[model samples]
Target: MARILLADDDEATRDLVKRALETDGHTVSITQDGAEALDTLTSAAATFDVLVSDVHMPGLDGVALAKRAIAAAPDLKLLLMSGFAEELDRAQALKSANLGVIIKPFTLDQIRAAVRALLA
Candidate 1:
């Protein structure tokens, strides 16, 4: 199973995504804020196969966190999720950051598919 760090400011959405990922045989670590998510990635003992984070959040946001995570672990895989379609345009901005993104309001199937594709 892949270890996934799930960061979302919304508790319900985080829980839902966590459950879905876990159900798909992924080990998920849930974080409520971007700062905490970045902390986990920067920690010396931190370990995660992939990161799934919301685009908008307090104290850093997913893009910033992804940048930091990539610096910390260049081989790390990232999956960013956002409710804003405008953020998709920023995908190019993340090219050097080494990350993939998904628009919000996505289905469990979509998430699972993304995860599978990344893991593959």
Candidate 2:
């Protein structure tokens, strides 16, 4: 199973997604905002197969988090999710391997498939 870091400002959203991902057998460490997420990623405990973050969050935002994380772990896989997914900067996705953007309002199955696809 893949190890994952999940970030979102919405508690409900984070909880729901984290539960879904965990149910899929991935080890997920979750944070309430992008800044906390970045801190977790840069910390010594930051060993993860992928980062699933909400595109719009306070302090850092998902794009900035992605940049910082890639600088720290270039081969790290990234998955960005948002209601305004199109507003996400695609440049980061191009720079990282296994990067994907998933639109919000997704079903559990959809999110599971997206993460599995990243691992595959």
Q: What is the per-residue lDDT of model 1 for residues 2-119, given as tens digits with 9 covering 90 to 100?
A: 9999999999899888888999899999899889998888888889999998988988888888888888888888898987877766754878544778888999889888887777
Residue 41 C-alpha lDDT in model 2: 86
lDDT of each: 0.85, 0.86
Collision pairs in model 2: none
Question: What are the candidates' C-alpha RMSDs?
Answer: 1.4, 1.6
The top-ranked prediction according to TM-score is 1
How close is every model to the real structure, measured as TM-score? 0.93, 0.92
Candidate 1, residue 12: Cα displacement in angstroms equals: 1.0
Residue-wise C-alpha lDDT for candidate 2, range 10-62, written one tens digit per residue: 99988888999999899999898889988898889678989999988888988
Model 2 scores a TM of 0.92
